[model samples]
Target: MSEKLRDQLVGAWKLHSYVEIPVDGSEPFYPMGEKPMGIIMYTPDGYMSAQLMKPGRAPFAVNDFYEGTLEEYKAAGSTYIAYTGPFKVNEQNRTLTHSMFISLFPNWMGQTQPRVVSIEGDVLTLGTASPISSKGKTVNSKLVWHRAQPE
Candidate 1:
């Protein structure tokens, strides 16, 4: 991978959009709701983390994280996604892979997913190369992010 691309990815990006296009030609779905919010950060040391969620999610009735009601737990689980791991860039193919070391979705733990990547100025676009099962449908996920500006 070129150092330039690596350098470009080593920063924080705020999610602008996240859409899942089904393979069966159905309407696209927004897993994190219409106006989702997220942040992904890549470090120079090859570490990365991403946190995404639906906006305006209700708080659990109980303040304890592990003592929420079943409905509250389900709501929280269905509305959020988070993972942290190491990342690798394949500059030759303009692709990037994130190997999950930790993930809220247990199934994704230890899985390595590849994404087709492109950068234009401050926008970073990532598309899943393979369809992933979501909400009982196979879909390709596309996410757009904007580079975070220094405060």
Candidate 2:
């Protein structure tokens, strides 16, 4: 039998990328030397959490020279967005919908969005709805989560 979506996602995975797609078909958001990274952990008790580890400085285009040291960047941890709620899969659409009753992002505190999740071998890809930044632009963030192997 094919593995259930829930079963495939029940584990700890690291983030690979976090992109922002522009609404006007302009250049999508890509970090400078952008090594977008993060982590996601889904529990058996209908609980899920995620954290995004991003580069602190781009190629000194806007903010002059890179001020922070490499050690600082490495030490400057990532932000997290977690929630505890129910999750269901729509096999027909190949989509996984998560109903987050509580979330770290205040906006998602009481909202649910249909997301696309695909698992190929050990890689888990997740696509979310258009995320609007403070400037009100629609962007699709593609987050790749790699399964963490037990040591």
The candidate scoring highest on lDDT is 1
Model 1 over residues 13-113: C-alpha lDDT tens digits? 99999999999999999999878899999999999999999999999887899899999989999999999999998776667999999999999999999
lDDT of each: 0.93, 0.68
Clashes in model 2: which pairs?
15-38
Poorest stretch of ten by lDDT in candidate 1: 1-10
Residue 60 lDDT (model 2): 27
Q: For each candidate, give its TM-score against the true structure.
A: 0.95, 0.70
Global CA lDDT of candidate 2, please?
0.68
In the range 1-151, model 2's lDDT, one tens digit per residue, is 7887888888899866666676678777753225756667788876677656455533322353367666544444223345657776776666777777877666777677788689998999888755566236777767777798787
RMSD of each: 1.6, 7.1
Best by TM-score: 1
- Candidate 2 regions exceeding 4 Å error are 31-33, 55-84, 129-135
C-alpha lDDT of residue 143 in model 1: 94
